[model samples]
Target: MASIHIPTLMLALLSGFAMLGVQLWAAQRSRLRYLDLAVWTWGSWTLLAGFAMLTARVVVPVWVSALLGNGLIALGIVFYNEAIHRHVLGRALPRWMWWSAPTVAWALTAWMLTWPLAVRTSAISLVFALLLCPAILVLLGPGWRGESSLRAVGLTLVAAAASLLLRSVHALTNPEEYRDLMQSSLGQGLTFLFSFICLIGAGFGFVLANFERIARRMEEMASTDGLTGCLNRMTADALLRHELERGRREGTPLAFVLLDLDHFKDVNDCHGHHAGDDALRAFAAEVRARLRASDVVGRWGGEEFGLVLPATDGPGAARLVEQIREAVATLRLCDGDGHDFTLTVSAGIAVAEPGGQLTADQLFMRADRALYRAKDGGRNNVQLHDSGWELGMESPAA
Candidate 1:
């Protein structure tokens, strides 16, 4: 209960500010400067503000300081959560979640108002701690894709918790000592708050850095395919829709092409499974080599590929797929046998009509049907679709 040390609190405030400055300086140098950078930068500044609040706590009574400290901590957590949601959560938090801030504030106000002045302060901190338990567990929970910042947030909360526990334990043993300490200039409260700021401020700094790292990682995971390192099926569909919309809006044509490797199952059968994987990888590489910078290619599924050709019409897409097919046919997978193995791909292309309604699922389906028709007519051929047609072939397993 000893009063917070004014000089130490000032030092903590300045140190926290210095940490914020460093965090900002480093944030600017990072490659991806967006909401993530802003969140981390703001988090550092909040820690400094929280430190200032703790410093102000010493001049006020222990009960007042505790309330203020709790409020500041809650605000800091709110900012941290916002950073996570902006960078990590693909969606926004619901309005119901907005109540947590004022709830913590109310809890702090109640705690301060209910402090017993005549007798000793009970272990009331326990109740607030228990209240915060759910939030703390949320940060450390399995669902948190916010791996980088979660530990830092947890550490900050834990530091505040330790201070509370320390003060509570000390107060129960010696009431007079606790009162005298609260009255003194460097009583338990100042020591506790100062210690809390140093430990938790540093923790917040770590959390900010992690927020950036985790956000970047999340983006990579969302947009890039794990196996081939190209765009994933989800991203490919999204990109197709985006490009189609753009083309429609600008009165331009965008091409959709579907490609399927012929006799791919035989390749898996003739060689070991690992060799089939290598062949698929080699086929992807060969196909990629024939593509232009404006084209986007992604594996639609096992033995299937989806291509998006922005600004290209149906004929252009056919020519591109034909080039890819020819390039793939020329590729020879060599083995120890005297004869070399060859691979071929059949392709289908379609152009989006101006003012035509097309959904991604429907577009892919049309192109895919064309691809199967080409496969049925003859392997390694391009079938360009003018209208929807069924090939009557069974869909392959993904």
Candidate 2:
């Protein structure tokens, strides 16, 4: 068997880990604050330190090389596992879990110092395999099913665990072939090579995963209103057009509603724009609470919102809007001066019945006209538009 240069592989791995650690540190500093990236950066540096100690086992004290080195490596794996847990589930493991694996591995390695080289190697390899198992489970779990980068990291962990397991079994069954840590052997060489590959794969996978998260967040921010947490005007318009097309194809009823807060300018003038913002946010929340998940609500510019209701008729849409109006009236808000106040909303609804050929503009115009009627009838009321040019009775203002 061709002897693999163990020292040379260790040096290369140390260098690789150092570079990966630096990149991760830079990413954590420059990009969005991700808890997982910070944890992984620490893990990379910890692993680098452990590898450095292991590489110098020839000159270092046996206790330092065997106990501290192995302990750090196990701790580093724990950090990696914790990072995966935080990234996927958005929570950290228990405090005890952070120290349990490293403590146990350190104690066991210390006790096994008097044992043969093969026995010590087998024991440590098993410890590494155990340390990596949780990370594998987290990355490959059902929660992250469609994340390809996470899956890649998961697969790399699986391979690393399998390699560690193989090394453990190989050392135990073929003790004479693994006499020394620095000796050139096929088993040691393959194990180290696999470790190196796993490090590179896992690091790259994490970076890609962070990028994916950032991109998704950017898309959401672009489509969402910053203050009210509703869909922005442009996204709402696009959604209305798409729903209109779908409703026409399926012959389903669709309702478009225009809602505006009554006397909104007075609130801003009386309580300042900050209070006005609070009212808008509260109104949006109440409206969202009363809406179905399939319903679409968007901030249609200042103090005005648009709703797209699928499979809703004229009467159903009116009832839902009335409920939203009552809910808004019950909201007790305080201004900057600690003065209590309430708000009312006026809504106008236009329904397109099945098989109707109403264009988006025409539907919007009808709804807009109905809204003006509601405002004119009273400050707070619900009005519906029908094909016969009939309007629903206005609800009394609270």
Off-target runs (Cα >4 Å) in candidate 2 are 31-33, 142-146, 265-279, 332-341, 353-357, 387-398
Steric overlap count per candidate: 8, 0
Error of model 1, residue 185, in angstroms: 25
lDDT of 2 at 106: 90
lDDT of 2 at 388: 59
| Local accuracy by lDDT, each model | 0.65, 0.86
lDDT of 1 at 64: 60
* Per-residue lDDT of model 2, residues 234-318, tens digit only: 9998999889999989889999999999999999999999999999999999999988989999999999999999989888898
Best by lDDT: 2
Give the per-residue lDDT digits (tens) of candidate 1, residues 1-398: 33565455567555766666576657656675656446555655664665566456558765566565556655554554555455444444455545666465647456556554312233444433443444455555632555555566656656656665666666665465445323444445553554446444644554465656767778989887666666788889899999999988988888898889999888877765666777788888887887789889888888888899998887777777888888899887854443457799888777787778887777887787778778887788988875624444443311
> Which residue pairs in model 2 clash with each other?
none
Query: If candidate 2 were superposed on the true structure by all CA atoms, what would the RMSD be?
Result: 3.5
